[model samples]
Target: MVKVLQQATEVDYGFRPSYRKVWMAKQKAIAQIYGDWEESYAELPRWMLRVQLTMAGTVTVLKTSPIKLGDQVDESTMYFHRLFWTFSPSIEAFRHCKPLVSIDGTHSYGKYGGTLLLAIAQDGNSNILPIAFALVEGENAESWSFFLSNLQSHVTPQVGILVISDRHNGIKAAHEAPENGWLPPRAFRAFCIRHVAANFSLSFKGKDARRMLVNAAYAKTEAEFYYWFDIMRTENPAMCDLANRMEYDKWTQHQNSGRQFGHMTTNISECVNSVLKGTRNLLVTSLVKSTYERLAELFVVRRQMAEAQMGIGAGSLRSTRQTGTEHPASVAYNGSHRRP
Candidate 1:
């Protein structure tokens, strides 16, 4: 010991101690976020979240708020996408919801290329509810088809027995894609009113045309729908030809009870954008994941209130249509209630 101290008299290298302390502190912080810290202690109660979600305040607060999970996203962004796009509605919710319909995608604005494709349903009250979502790069047949094929996972065969969306030209091509070849025709797919409006407005361009189109759609009876359509066609001959040649079957879909139909419009899917209006601009790395975390928090509370009103027991509210080949339990559910 005496010999060693004598040799090291001025060689202590005093900066070494503080360097180790800083390194250790950084390691501890990383462990806290990743391993087990209680920060995610379900601080926001379900009911409180619902009250905040009521179309106003909840959405307002979601814009600037951030969470620790933003760091969890990977460098390639592919893994971040696979996690975020596939997480919403939870697999349980997907399994229980029935007659799922209406799929559509819209682009997101930010440095990162992203679009949102959503699968929606009509609740017992006839209001729209979302069951799954995807953040895509652009709106195309490929993206929409991928969303549908992936959506099949959430479905019990009887659950999403019918579905709807804009019947974009690429849809059939995607449906016939080698992987999606096995889906049945009865898992029916159709288009929404927005697609109708887009097709109609392209050929019939006047205030009168707009009124005729909207009125015919809102009409409840077959007679009323056709009577309105007949008048629309009589007023515009060229438009009539386009409707007959290109869109007649589209109008017929609503009239046919032959297949289950969901919503007349894509408004419900678009409604989500309104809910998270400004949150999309907040993060650099995991913007999609961050948006979803806020959405998941919002849905938890929103579903609580929705369930309470429907009188389903606490766990029952999470029920969904059976997917894959599982048999459905015989149960009765009404426009505003569910019973098993």
Candidate 2:
């Protein structure tokens, strides 16, 4: 901000403003443009209503605390507590993507501090698709329960889905709770390998120990996983004990039966978090607006790419029909030249 002010003001007036002045001016400009923080909270309902009205199937859940006067509730008074929203396209897109969800939270830098929780999925082409978002007071058991419960109830209701996240107690508490639908036979929970390795490093130390943990996590076979496991045991017996306590099935690829879709970390969710980094400091409504606009633009671009791919596929099929001795359809129907 100071640099921008220097470029805009100093170049014209040959004078540089102090940091305080620039900051105050920026705050005033933000207020003038996006309104104050309290007003942004007031606008959340209207903005969310417009989103749902225009985009059918969009889900929004807003939790607010009602203000009370003596024994009666003031109908006009309410304070924003939490919000969970997901777009229709994102919800539909998850159906075709891998049956895995990675969730993570990042701190919001707005004047009214909060945390943004994200749930992301990976498409067949390995593209990251953000499926749901929630703004909460912080990353706690209650907040995680609020986000994950809504995510499962509305966004990812498919049973036996794999959920990957860090080893936060809040996430564990929420995921392990029987009513949250994140336990076994409903949805499986896995720890992010990166976070697991980081915690291991804190105890074991050294890059070699971390590398061994990562190798074990990425092993495609039980034998290969044990090979790395033995190496960690040889390096430090304590490492094996820690791994055992954390449960090998949650972090090891071999135990998940490919349900993890080769994802070992919450990097996809963190990538989406970084994508929204610029809007973190904006007013609440503006931050939500930015996510909506950015995701809409992303959907438009991906749609164009998909259409282009379809066009290319059709062109190749027509060309093959014109130049080939036997039709591709006959090869598939007759199963003569098709390889099993």
Candidate 3:
């Protein structure tokens, strides 16, 4: 197992293969050359600990349980309840990215079923920058508060930071609670437009209503917002009422109070969740290791791409594709300073 892991890591430092892929590779190698060998998924936690210990300083782990009896240390009574990890480099890189972060949670299908919560940021080039990850017992107020408190302490401590998420009650409560320290004066919260649209669809049935609601949320000016919102009001007053009940400053682009940075949704965090879909069924430790390795590989690849782009002068034509319609070099002036 150690040899295979080492070989995999050598091939790609990220080395994130699904458990099924690993199992198949092992089966094939055994049939081809080595004698019969047996392995079970139960051993993955031990192997993951070994890897974490090997890379001790690079990986940070925090574990907690409800059965803390103060030095009594009952082995059977104590079990893994929550785990949070962040790689050294990821934490450092987050300092350079935007203060805007989107957080979300997804369920993990590993042997110990739990919820995986992630806090992700966006780089200047619009790439997903992972900040921290946590595996909690459930998606409740306590879990979210714990995750966000740790994230703030470890990754971001700047004031006026913006956080985006869906309308989950737990998230809402955590950010609003004074003790959580996520309220304004330090951090602000924004709602995802997608979740708003989903709620609108539930209350109002037609496609046009959905379109109108989206238009209002995406409007860049107050006049444009009213124009779209009035249409929705006329079509279905109840939908408008539901929307008005929500703090317009949180979901509407025009009323975001300059915190959202033009982002109206939590799609960035959702995209990261989708990228790790394959690792959902792995053991807890393997899941954490895979996330670290994958993020490291992404950082390396993106940095190389940025360097290659930098080699081409910034003032070159490659950067002017979005200038639209009139190219300064293409306009030819006649003797009268006018085009024929």
Candidate 4:
């Protein structure tokens, strides 16, 4: 709160309400942006304040330990090496705003071989919303399963959520595994098309063959997709045989998950990754705190853009995507664009 006072203008929160029911989210985010300021900017114009905040602060303060509150009163002193969840007011920042969720794990460079599993969603507005995240070890079926199970435990479930992710052996099994008396069945899992193609291409020869087969998998319509599948099956019986045996169709779920380009291979998740390239690697305390803060900055930019557009940019709501519809995928803060 002290930091916020230094960074933001004194916008009277009385009478004039510019937001919807989610006022708290907006307020918290505004505080975070200004809270990093070195001195008060109360006299600055609002737009300039936002711009100043975008390039505000130094790295030392960015990585400083969070101010601990009150007196410590804990019995157990277990080392918190892995972080399981993350919270932000703009958590719902996504374009194809849907209850749709995606979960993935990135290996941590820290000791003990750790992995972070992040569960994200699309919010009411079209921002790549981050629901919850977790830190785990060795991203495998057991770890992923526990992560998903924990996510389910935390959030409120929407009617039909189609979760898009890779066909990692662990994740696939975790989705299919008998809930161990827990977890949900409707959490339809989808395999990354690129991963599937790359893995399948490794088994065959010639560039044409790989391209042909890959196209078949991404062919827009189910008819076209299946048509390509059959052609590939004939061209490379071994590949088809491998796919059938592994039941890959059981995981090719996104095509029907009601989102723009769900049928095609869209690496939006990786696009998000490119945004945090170095930041994720610099994470500490088992949590990518720095990454989280940077992401907040990215969201502020998106918020500004969203304000400018004034018009709905396709996947701009928790709405579904279908044939002929186009949506702007979420933008990320590629660290390379550092404002010197």
Which candidate comes out best when scored by TM-score? 2
Query: Candidate 4, residues 109-144: lDDT per residue as tens digits?
Result: 432346756666655544565656655657777777
Query: What is candidate 1's lDDT per residue for 151-190, written digit by digit as tens?
Result: 6644433532656556677665665565753255536555
Better of 3 and 4 by lDDT: 3
Give each model's whole-structure lDDT: 0.52, 0.88, 0.76, 0.51
lDDT tens readout by residue for model 3, 229-329:
88877877887788889888888989887788889899999899999987775656557768978987997998788676655534343445556534555
lDDT winner between 1 and 3, please give it: 3
lDDT of 2: 0.88
Best candidate, lDDT-wise? 2
| Candidates ranked, most accurate by lDDT first | 2, 3, 1, 4
Off by over 4 Å in 4: 1-77, 88-96, 111-113, 122-129, 178-185, 246-266, 310-340
Q: How accurate locally is residue 145 in candidate 3, as Cα lDDT from 0 to 100?
A: 84
- Which residue segments of model 3 deviate by more than 4 Å? 1-61, 66-77, 310-340
323 Cα displacement, candidate 4 (Å) = 38
TM-score of each: 0.58, 0.88, 0.74, 0.58
Name the 10 consecutive residues with the lowest summed lDDT in model 2: 331-340
